[model samples]
Target: MAERSDFSFLDEAEATCRLAMDPAATGIDLCLILERDALLPAVESIDAAGFFIEDVAVLDVAEGYQARYHFRRFDTKGRIELRVTAPHDDPHIPSIANIFQGAEWHERESMDFYGVTFDGNPNPARLLLPEDATIKPLEKDEKSRKSYLDLMPEFTIVECAEGHPIEELAAKRQAEREEAERKAAEEAKKAEEEAKKAAEEEAAKQSEEAGEAG
Candidate 1:
């Protein structure tokens, strides 16, 4: 387990994750945004650092304003995430992808529906909304907003290990363990066969001597 750091610096957002720094910064505060499967361990990792969870916050949308969850995190040094929400009518949040390069997709997503803009993002292209698709699907009324999280299937939270992707590491470990076990079983079988052959030879020699004496 990694040791926790002092996270008192980030209480402004409701549920922000103080992402551990990449090569770019010594440290940074990331405002997290949640889609469907983007929570899980990443959420817990941020929460373990002592961030607050705010179920409500205000967003500055170009068309108008809206209310949504706004969480905050702070005092972290590496890959971290902050989750925020906006209203069904114009869902939008400030993009921190510039501060944390990984925020590009999240900012793009915010733009897809809420039409929010990241102040200085290089590529705020469509994310969830596909190219040339004529549907702002997430734009919602009160009833539709209730099941936004549930409706989205691609919400699996993936940890961004700048040095190592968790998926590859896990597969490697599993393969090593299996290989070791297979070798051990083969050695044991070979030893057992040698012992059995030796015992059979000894029994045959003794019987031949007894028959000659009789």
Candidate 2:
């Protein structure tokens, strides 16, 4: 269980996109769903916090192309995930290679597999696929794609400083989960009461029969 204040450096970054998540559930302490423009400042703040960039990954979903940046610190117990989405038609995200040089190859790998453009990358060349390849082999078709929220159902957005587009959806999903749990509990209590009543009736019947026989 990590608090927002645990990562104080985020105050200098985008606080509105900050989310405190359950580390036990997601294996991530904090998550930030940042806009394209806010990505660089967030990364800079993480670096200032003594966190190193572990990996940069891209996911093709119904919403768009999601770029995930994983960060971790040796002395800390928490891991942070920074997410930025780009439209499917315009899959362009600002490159973090300038801040973390190691991110250059990771971003290039993403470009090769998902056709994502890492703008400002010193060298935007394919790492795995052929240079002449035009198709992104890892991209999913429209029918097979899943929304970002759908894939990350375990993440509950507890706080949002500024209203975000996905805040409403997260709230709705949380409400639905609570309602389902409430209904299941009610059903269990009702079943228990019914079973208790049936047992009482059976005992009364047997006692009356025994009294009449005596």
lDDT of each: 0.47, 0.86
For each candidate, give its TM-score against the true structure: 0.33, 0.90
Report the C-alpha lDDT of model 2 over 1-214, residue by residue, as the tens digit.
4333357677566645667778888878788888899999889888877889899999999989999999988766888899999999999999999999999999999999999999999989789988999988899999999988777736666567656756877778879989999999999999999999999999999999999999
Worst 10 residues of 2 by lDDT: 1-10
- Candidate 1 on 1-214: residue-level lDDT in tens? 4444444443333332223333243232343444323433344444555654433323333223332333344453333334344444544445444444555665566566556555466786677777776655455544334332322212222343344323344455568779999999999998999999899899999999999999
For each candidate, C-alpha RMSD in Å? 14.0, 2.7
Model 1: lDDT to the true structure: 0.47
Best by lDDT: 2
Given candidate 2, what's the lDDT at residue 129? 89
Report residue 197 deviation for candidate 1 (angstroms). 75
Residue 60, candidate 2: alpha-carbon lDDT: 92
